[model samples]
Target: MRTLAAIVLICTATAPQAHPHIFIDTGLTAIVDDAGALQAVKVTWAYDAFYSLLITEDYGLDPDGNAVLTPDEEAQLRGFDMQWIEGFDGDLVARLDGGSLELSRPRDVTLVMREGRLVTTHVRDVAGTPAMAGHILSMKPFDPTYYTSYDVTMNVRVQGLEGCAIVRNLPDLDAGMQQLQGALTKLGRDQDAIEEGFPEVGEAFATEVEITCADR
Candidate 1:
Protein backbone atom coordinates (compact mmCIF):
# COMPACT_ATOMS: atom_id res chain seq x y z
CA MET A 1 0.00 0.00 0.00
CA ARG A 2 1.10 3.61 -0.55
CA THR A 3 1.88 5.75 2.50
CA LEU A 4 3.10 9.29 2.94
CA ALA A 5 5.19 10.96 5.63
CA ALA A 6 2.97 11.50 8.67
CA ILE A 7 2.83 14.42 11.13
CA VAL A 8 3.04 17.55 8.99
CA LEU A 9 3.90 21.12 10.05
CA ILE A 10 2.92 24.34 8.20
CA CYS A 11 3.68 27.08 10.71
CA THR A 12 5.45 30.27 9.60
CA ALA A 13 7.28 32.91 11.63
CA THR A 14 6.00 36.43 11.77
CA ALA A 15 5.77 39.25 14.28
CA PRO A 16 4.16 38.34 17.58
CA GLN A 17 0.62 37.44 16.56
CA ALA A 18 -2.17 38.89 18.65
CA HIS A 19 -3.66 35.49 19.30
CA PRO A 20 -1.63 33.05 21.36
CA HIS A 21 1.00 31.33 19.19
CA ILE A 22 4.35 29.72 19.95
CA PHE A 23 7.68 29.33 18.21
CA ILE A 24 8.93 26.07 16.63
CA ASP A 25 12.53 25.22 15.94
CA THR A 26 15.35 22.68 15.98
CA GLY A 27 18.14 25.09 16.92
CA LEU A 28 17.89 25.08 20.67
CA THR A 29 19.31 23.77 23.92
CA ALA A 30 17.60 23.57 27.29
CA ILE A 31 18.72 23.53 30.91
CA VAL A 32 16.76 21.70 33.53
CA ASP A 33 16.29 23.90 36.54
CA ASP A 34 13.96 24.33 39.49
CA ALA A 35 11.66 27.28 39.80
CA GLY A 36 11.13 27.40 43.52
CA ALA A 37 8.47 24.73 44.01
CA LEU A 38 7.80 24.23 40.31
CA GLN A 39 10.10 22.81 37.68
CA ALA A 40 11.86 25.46 35.62
CA VAL A 41 13.28 24.82 32.21
CA LYS A 42 15.22 27.09 29.84
CA VAL A 43 15.49 26.54 26.06
CA THR A 44 17.24 27.85 22.99
CA TRP A 45 15.33 27.35 19.69
CA ALA A 46 15.77 26.56 15.98
CA TYR A 47 12.96 27.58 13.62
CA ASP A 48 13.64 27.03 9.93
CA ALA A 49 10.51 25.68 8.38
CA PHE A 50 9.34 27.87 5.51
CA TYR A 51 5.66 27.84 6.47
CA SER A 52 3.23 26.57 9.12
CA LEU A 53 -0.51 26.03 9.31
CA LEU A 54 -2.52 27.44 12.19
CA ILE A 55 -4.65 24.67 13.71
CA THR A 56 -6.89 27.47 14.97
CA GLU A 57 -7.33 31.07 13.88
CA ASP A 58 -6.30 34.34 15.49
CA TYR A 59 -9.82 35.54 16.38
CA GLY A 60 -8.47 38.56 18.23
CA LEU A 61 -7.65 40.16 14.89
CA ASP A 62 -10.12 41.41 12.30
CA PRO A 63 -10.62 40.06 8.79
CA ASP A 64 -8.39 42.76 7.29
CA GLY A 65 -5.47 41.85 9.49
CA ASN A 66 -5.92 38.12 9.13
CA ALA A 67 -4.61 36.48 5.97
CA VAL A 68 -8.20 36.21 4.70
CA LEU A 69 -10.55 33.27 4.69
CA THR A 70 -13.09 31.47 2.54
CA PRO A 71 -16.67 30.84 3.68
CA ASP A 72 -15.77 27.34 4.82
CA GLU A 73 -12.57 28.39 6.54
CA GLU A 74 -14.37 31.24 8.25
CA ALA A 75 -16.97 28.85 9.57
CA GLN A 76 -14.33 26.63 11.15
CA LEU A 77 -12.81 29.67 12.83
CA ARG A 78 -16.14 31.11 13.94
CA GLY A 79 -16.73 29.05 17.07
CA PHE A 80 -14.05 28.25 19.57
CA ASP A 81 -11.51 30.11 21.70
CA MET A 82 -9.62 30.32 18.36
CA GLN A 83 -6.14 30.64 19.64
CA TRP A 84 -3.15 28.35 19.82
CA ILE A 85 -4.94 26.71 22.71
CA GLU A 86 -7.54 23.98 22.30
CA GLY A 87 -11.11 25.22 22.53
CA PHE A 88 -12.23 22.20 24.55
CA ASP A 89 -11.23 18.80 25.80
CA GLY A 90 -13.76 17.21 23.46
CA ASP A 91 -11.32 17.98 20.69
CA LEU A 92 -8.95 15.52 22.31
CA VAL A 93 -11.43 13.05 23.77
CA ALA A 94 -13.01 12.53 20.37
CA ARG A 95 -9.70 11.38 18.90
CA LEU A 96 -9.16 8.79 21.61
CA ASP A 97 -11.90 6.52 20.29
CA GLY A 98 -10.22 5.23 17.13
CA GLY A 99 -6.50 4.59 17.51
CA SER A 100 -4.33 4.81 20.64
CA LEU A 101 -3.78 8.22 22.26
CA GLU A 102 -2.18 9.76 25.36
CA LEU A 103 -1.46 13.18 26.91
CA SER A 104 0.94 14.29 29.63
CA ARG A 105 2.05 17.09 31.95
CA PRO A 106 5.79 17.19 32.28
CA ARG A 107 7.76 19.02 34.95
CA ASP A 108 9.30 21.36 32.39
CA VAL A 109 10.63 21.57 28.79
CA THR A 110 13.50 23.54 27.30
CA LEU A 111 15.56 24.02 24.11
CA VAL A 112 19.08 22.71 23.91
CA MET A 113 21.99 22.66 21.41
CA ARG A 114 25.17 20.87 22.36
CA GLU A 115 28.36 21.05 20.29
CA GLY A 116 27.08 22.54 17.02
CA ARG A 117 23.50 21.95 15.98
CA LEU A 118 20.45 23.84 14.76
CA VAL A 119 18.16 25.61 17.22
CA THR A 120 15.61 23.15 18.62
CA THR A 121 13.02 24.10 21.23
CA HIS A 122 10.61 22.03 23.27
CA VAL A 123 6.84 22.39 23.33
CA ARG A 124 6.36 24.03 26.70
CA ASP A 125 2.77 24.63 27.86
CA VAL A 126 1.35 23.16 24.68
CA ALA A 127 -1.31 20.66 23.64
CA GLY A 128 -1.40 18.25 20.69
CA THR A 129 -3.87 18.96 17.92
CA PRO A 130 -5.30 16.40 15.48
CA ALA A 131 -3.38 16.08 12.26
CA MET A 132 -6.18 14.38 10.36
CA ALA A 133 -8.97 13.74 12.79
CA GLY A 134 -11.01 12.22 9.95
CA HIS A 135 -8.32 9.68 9.10
CA ILE A 136 -6.98 8.80 12.55
CA LEU A 137 -8.10 9.08 16.14
CA SER A 138 -5.99 9.54 19.26
CA MET A 139 -3.42 12.33 19.11
CA LYS A 140 -0.43 13.06 21.29
CA PRO A 141 -1.85 15.48 23.83
CA PHE A 142 -1.02 19.16 23.74
CA ASP A 143 -0.43 20.17 27.37
CA PRO A 144 -1.43 23.59 28.66
CA THR A 145 2.03 23.80 30.17
CA TYR A 146 3.46 24.09 26.67
CA TYR A 147 0.50 25.96 25.32
CA THR A 148 2.66 28.72 23.87
CA SER A 149 5.60 26.51 23.02
CA TYR A 150 6.55 23.94 20.35
CA ASP A 151 7.46 20.26 20.42
CA VAL A 152 9.61 17.90 18.41
CA THR A 153 7.26 14.94 18.87
CA MET A 154 3.77 15.00 17.36
CA ASN A 155 1.08 12.24 17.56
CA VAL A 156 -0.84 10.62 14.74
CA ARG A 157 -3.16 7.61 14.26
CA VAL A 158 -6.19 9.80 13.74
CA GLN A 159 -8.84 9.45 11.04
CA GLY A 160 -7.79 12.75 9.46
CA LEU A 161 -4.37 11.44 8.51
CA GLU A 162 -5.60 8.45 6.53
CA GLY A 163 -5.20 10.40 3.34
CA CYS A 164 -1.45 10.64 3.71
CA ALA A 165 -1.08 7.15 5.06
CA ILE A 166 -2.89 5.79 2.03
CA VAL A 167 -0.73 7.71 -0.43
CA ARG A 168 2.69 6.89 1.00
CA ASN A 169 4.68 4.26 2.84
CA LEU A 170 3.85 5.63 6.26
CA PRO A 171 4.15 3.66 9.43
CA ASP A 172 1.06 1.78 10.47
CA LEU A 173 -1.18 3.01 13.27
CA ASP A 174 0.59 0.46 15.44
CA ALA A 175 3.64 2.69 15.39
CA GLY A 176 1.43 5.55 16.42
CA MET A 177 0.73 3.61 19.62
CA GLN A 178 4.42 3.32 20.40
CA GLN A 179 4.74 7.07 19.99
CA LEU A 180 1.90 7.67 22.46
CA GLN A 181 3.65 5.67 25.15
CA GLY A 182 6.72 7.85 24.86
CA ALA A 183 4.70 11.06 25.11
CA LEU A 184 3.31 9.88 28.44
CA THR A 185 6.78 9.71 29.91
CA LYS A 186 7.54 13.21 28.64
CA LEU A 187 4.50 14.76 30.31
CA GLY A 188 5.68 15.02 33.93
CA ARG A 189 9.35 14.30 33.42
CA ASP A 190 12.10 16.50 32.01
CA GLN A 191 12.52 14.33 28.96
CA ASP A 192 12.42 15.07 25.22
CA ALA A 193 10.40 13.42 22.45
CA ILE A 194 11.43 13.82 18.80
CA GLU A 195 8.65 11.94 17.10
CA GLU A 196 9.33 11.65 13.39
CA GLY A 197 6.83 12.23 10.64
CA PHE A 198 6.20 14.48 7.63
CA PRO A 199 6.09 18.26 7.84
CA GLU A 200 2.71 19.83 6.94
CA VAL A 201 3.58 21.55 3.69
CA GLY A 202 3.39 19.82 0.32
CA GLU A 203 0.58 17.40 1.12
CA ALA A 204 -2.84 17.85 2.68
CA PHE A 205 -2.18 15.17 5.30
CA ALA A 206 0.74 17.18 6.64
CA THR A 207 -1.40 19.00 9.13
CA GLU A 208 -0.25 17.72 12.50
CA VAL A 209 3.11 18.82 13.91
CA GLU A 210 5.62 18.33 16.74
CA ILE A 211 8.40 20.94 16.60
CA THR A 212 11.68 19.76 18.04
CA CYS A 213 13.62 21.32 20.94
CA ALA A 214 17.35 21.75 20.57
CA ASP A 215 20.15 24.31 20.91
CA ARG A 216 21.53 26.47 18.14
Candidate 2:
Protein backbone atom coordinates (compact mmCIF):
# COMPACT_ATOMS: atom_id res chain seq x y z
CA MET A 1 0.00 0.00 0.00
CA ARG A 2 1.18 3.51 -0.81
CA THR A 3 0.86 5.52 2.37
CA LEU A 4 0.55 9.29 2.50
CA ALA A 5 3.35 9.50 5.03
CA ALA A 6 5.75 7.73 2.71
CA ILE A 7 4.79 9.93 -0.24
CA VAL A 8 5.13 13.06 1.87
CA LEU A 9 8.54 12.04 3.10
CA ILE A 10 9.72 11.28 -0.39
CA CYS A 11 8.41 14.54 -1.78
CA THR A 12 9.72 16.58 1.12
CA ALA A 13 13.16 15.12 0.71
CA THR A 14 13.21 15.33 -3.07
CA ALA A 15 11.18 18.38 -4.06
CA PRO A 16 10.45 20.37 -0.89
CA GLN A 17 7.43 21.95 -2.58
CA ALA A 18 4.25 22.66 -0.64
CA HIS A 19 1.25 20.48 -1.38
CA PRO A 20 0.83 18.41 -4.59
CA HIS A 21 3.72 16.15 -3.70
CA ILE A 22 3.15 14.09 -6.83
CA PHE A 23 1.80 14.72 -10.31
CA ILE A 24 0.05 12.38 -12.69
CA ASP A 25 -1.02 12.84 -16.28
CA THR A 26 -4.42 11.24 -16.45
CA GLY A 27 -6.58 9.74 -19.21
CA LEU A 28 -10.20 8.62 -19.02
CA THR A 29 -12.40 6.65 -21.41
CA ALA A 30 -16.10 6.27 -20.77
CA ILE A 31 -17.56 3.00 -21.98
CA VAL A 32 -21.13 2.74 -23.19
CA ASP A 33 -23.30 -0.13 -24.27
CA ASP A 34 -25.19 -0.43 -27.57
CA ALA A 35 -28.14 1.31 -25.99
CA GLY A 36 -25.89 4.29 -25.18
CA ALA A 37 -25.91 3.44 -21.50
CA LEU A 38 -22.75 4.11 -19.50
CA GLN A 39 -21.10 0.89 -18.43
CA ALA A 40 -17.54 1.57 -17.30
CA VAL A 41 -14.64 3.92 -17.40
CA LYS A 42 -11.02 3.15 -18.15
CA VAL A 43 -8.53 5.33 -16.34
CA THR A 44 -4.86 5.75 -17.12
CA TRP A 45 -2.25 7.46 -15.03
CA ALA A 46 1.31 8.33 -15.98
CA TYR A 47 3.41 9.34 -13.02
CA ASP A 48 5.94 12.12 -13.20
CA ALA A 49 9.48 11.02 -13.75
CA PHE A 50 10.66 11.97 -10.28
CA TYR A 51 7.86 10.15 -8.51
CA SER A 52 8.33 7.19 -10.82
CA LEU A 53 11.96 7.01 -9.85
CA LEU A 54 11.05 7.02 -6.18
CA ILE A 55 8.55 4.21 -6.68
CA THR A 56 11.06 2.17 -8.61
CA GLU A 57 13.66 2.68 -5.94
CA ASP A 58 11.30 1.96 -3.11
CA TYR A 59 10.23 -1.29 -4.71
CA GLY A 60 13.86 -2.21 -5.42
CA LEU A 61 12.95 -2.77 -9.05
CA ASP A 62 14.94 -1.63 -12.07
CA PRO A 63 18.26 -2.11 -10.35
CA ASP A 64 19.96 -1.40 -13.62
CA GLY A 65 18.35 2.03 -13.61
CA ASN A 66 17.49 1.46 -17.26
CA ALA A 67 13.76 1.72 -16.50
CA VAL A 68 13.24 -1.70 -17.99
CA LEU A 69 11.69 -4.38 -15.81
CA THR A 70 11.88 -8.11 -16.33
CA PRO A 71 8.72 -10.13 -16.62
CA ASP A 72 9.00 -11.21 -12.98
CA GLU A 73 9.67 -7.65 -11.92
CA GLU A 74 6.69 -6.50 -13.93
CA ALA A 75 4.49 -9.02 -12.18
CA GLN A 76 5.72 -7.78 -8.83
CA LEU A 77 5.05 -4.20 -9.80
CA ARG A 78 1.49 -4.87 -10.88
CA GLY A 79 -1.23 -3.31 -8.75
CA PHE A 80 1.31 -1.33 -6.72
CA ASP A 81 -1.03 1.62 -6.66
CA MET A 82 -4.38 -0.14 -6.42
CA GLN A 83 -4.09 -1.24 -2.83
CA TRP A 84 -6.70 1.19 -1.72
CA ILE A 85 -7.31 1.65 1.98
CA GLU A 86 -10.86 1.76 3.25
CA GLY A 87 -12.78 4.87 2.23
CA PHE A 88 -10.34 5.76 -0.52
CA ASP A 89 -12.23 6.74 -3.66
CA GLY A 90 -9.44 5.98 -6.14
CA ASP A 91 -9.23 9.69 -6.90
CA LEU A 92 -12.16 9.61 -9.31
CA VAL A 93 -15.49 11.42 -9.13
CA ALA A 94 -18.31 10.69 -11.54
CA ARG A 95 -21.65 12.39 -11.39
CA LEU A 96 -24.86 12.57 -13.34
CA ASP A 97 -27.68 15.06 -12.82
CA GLY A 98 -25.95 16.40 -9.71
CA GLY A 99 -25.96 12.97 -8.10
CA SER A 100 -22.86 10.91 -7.45
CA LEU A 101 -22.40 7.76 -9.48
CA GLU A 102 -21.05 4.72 -7.70
CA LEU A 103 -18.07 3.02 -9.32
CA SER A 104 -16.69 -0.38 -8.62
CA ARG A 105 -13.14 -0.95 -7.47
CA PRO A 106 -10.38 -0.91 -10.04
CA ARG A 107 -10.01 -3.97 -12.23
CA ASP A 108 -8.21 -4.98 -15.43
CA VAL A 109 -5.17 -3.20 -14.06
CA THR A 110 -1.99 -2.95 -16.10
CA LEU A 111 1.29 -1.33 -15.16
CA VAL A 112 4.42 -0.76 -17.17
CA MET A 113 7.48 1.41 -17.38
CA ARG A 114 7.37 3.71 -20.35
CA GLU A 115 10.12 6.20 -21.09
CA GLY A 116 11.26 6.08 -17.45
CA ARG A 117 7.77 6.80 -16.12
CA LEU A 118 5.38 4.45 -14.40
CA VAL A 119 2.19 4.26 -16.43
CA THR A 120 -0.79 2.32 -15.16
CA THR A 121 -4.32 1.68 -16.39
CA HIS A 122 -7.40 0.38 -14.66
CA VAL A 123 -11.09 -0.10 -15.33
CA ARG A 124 -13.89 0.91 -13.00
CA ASP A 125 -17.34 -0.40 -13.82
CA VAL A 126 -20.29 1.81 -13.15
CA ALA A 127 -22.80 0.39 -10.71
CA GLY A 128 -25.84 0.79 -12.96
CA THR A 129 -26.29 1.31 -16.65
CA PRO A 130 -27.33 4.90 -16.97
CA ALA A 131 -28.49 6.04 -20.37
CA MET A 132 -26.59 9.03 -21.71
CA ALA A 133 -28.93 10.23 -24.41
CA GLY A 134 -30.39 13.14 -22.53
CA HIS A 135 -28.20 13.41 -19.44
CA ILE A 136 -24.76 14.88 -18.89
CA LEU A 137 -22.04 12.94 -17.14
CA SER A 138 -19.13 14.63 -15.44
CA MET A 139 -15.92 13.02 -14.26
CA LYS A 140 -12.83 14.27 -12.53
CA PRO A 141 -9.72 12.79 -10.98
CA PHE A 142 -8.18 14.39 -7.93
CA ASP A 143 -6.87 13.79 -4.45
CA PRO A 144 -9.01 15.66 -1.95
CA THR A 145 -6.15 16.65 0.33
CA TYR A 146 -4.15 18.01 -2.61
CA TYR A 147 -1.30 15.70 -1.78
CA THR A 148 -1.25 14.63 -5.42
CA SER A 149 -2.32 16.58 -8.45
CA TYR A 150 -3.95 14.91 -11.42
CA ASP A 151 -4.16 16.53 -14.84
CA VAL A 152 -6.23 15.12 -17.63
CA THR A 153 -3.49 15.59 -20.15
CA MET A 154 -4.15 12.47 -22.15
CA ASN A 155 -7.13 11.33 -24.14
CA VAL A 156 -10.74 11.55 -22.98
CA ARG A 157 -13.14 9.59 -25.11
CA VAL A 158 -16.39 7.67 -25.11
CA GLN A 159 -16.53 4.19 -26.60
CA GLY A 160 -19.45 2.34 -28.13
CA LEU A 161 -21.57 5.46 -28.24
CA GLU A 162 -22.43 7.63 -31.20
CA GLY A 163 -23.09 11.34 -31.24
CA CYS A 164 -21.53 11.71 -27.82
CA ALA A 165 -19.24 14.64 -27.35
CA ILE A 166 -16.58 14.97 -24.69
CA VAL A 167 -15.59 18.30 -23.34
CA ARG A 168 -12.63 19.07 -21.08
CA ASN A 169 -13.18 21.78 -18.56
CA LEU A 170 -10.01 23.35 -17.32
CA PRO A 171 -9.91 24.51 -13.74
CA ASP A 172 -9.51 28.13 -12.84
CA LEU A 173 -6.06 28.04 -11.33
CA ASP A 174 -6.16 31.62 -10.08
CA ALA A 175 -9.34 30.99 -8.17
CA GLY A 176 -8.11 27.68 -6.90
CA MET A 177 -4.91 29.26 -5.65
CA GLN A 178 -6.84 31.97 -3.94
CA GLN A 179 -9.01 29.42 -2.20
CA LEU A 180 -5.95 27.47 -1.03
CA GLN A 181 -4.29 30.58 0.26
CA GLY A 182 -7.41 31.54 2.14
CA ALA A 183 -7.57 28.13 3.76
CA LEU A 184 -3.92 28.28 4.65
CA THR A 185 -4.32 31.71 6.19
CA LYS A 186 -6.98 30.35 8.48
CA LEU A 187 -4.45 27.80 9.73
CA GLY A 188 -1.87 30.48 10.61
CA ARG A 189 1.86 30.36 9.84
CA ASP A 190 2.96 28.63 13.01
CA GLN A 191 0.52 25.76 12.61
CA ASP A 192 1.42 22.65 10.67
CA ALA A 193 -1.07 22.48 7.83
CA ILE A 194 -1.21 18.71 7.78
CA GLU A 195 -1.53 18.31 11.50
CA GLU A 196 -4.11 21.07 11.59
CA GLY A 197 -6.02 19.16 8.93
CA PHE A 198 -5.42 20.58 5.52
CA PRO A 199 -8.60 21.48 3.71
CA GLU A 200 -9.94 19.21 0.97
CA VAL A 201 -9.86 21.59 -1.96
CA GLY A 202 -8.43 19.46 -4.72
CA GLU A 203 -11.62 19.57 -6.75
CA ALA A 204 -11.20 23.30 -6.99
CA PHE A 205 -8.07 22.72 -9.08
CA ALA A 206 -9.15 19.63 -10.99
CA THR A 207 -9.98 19.36 -14.68
CA GLU A 208 -13.47 18.01 -15.21
CA VAL A 209 -14.56 16.04 -18.26
CA GLU A 210 -18.16 16.23 -19.35
CA ILE A 211 -19.84 13.81 -21.73
CA THR A 212 -23.10 14.43 -23.50
CA CYS A 213 -24.89 12.61 -26.26
CA ALA A 214 -27.36 13.86 -28.80
CA ASP A 215 -30.81 12.34 -28.82
CA ARG A 216 -30.93 9.08 -30.72
Rate residue 32 of model 1 by lDDT. Answer: 22
Candidate 1 contains a number of clashing pairs equal to 82
lDDT per model vs. reference: 0.27, 0.83
lDDT of 1 at 161: 15
lDDT of 1 at 106: 30
Q: Tell me the tens digit of each residue's lDDT in model 2 across 133-162.
A: 878999989999787888888999989987
Model 1 whole-model lDDT (C-alpha atoms): 0.27
- Candidate 2 wrongly placed segments (more than 4 Å): 1-17, 188-190
For model 1, give the 10-residue run with minimal summed lDDT: 1-10
Output the lDDT of residue 181, model 1: 35
TM-score for candidate 1, please give it: 0.21
Quantify how close model 2 is to the true structure by its C-alpha RMSD in Å.
Answer: 5.0
lDDT of 1 at 200: 21
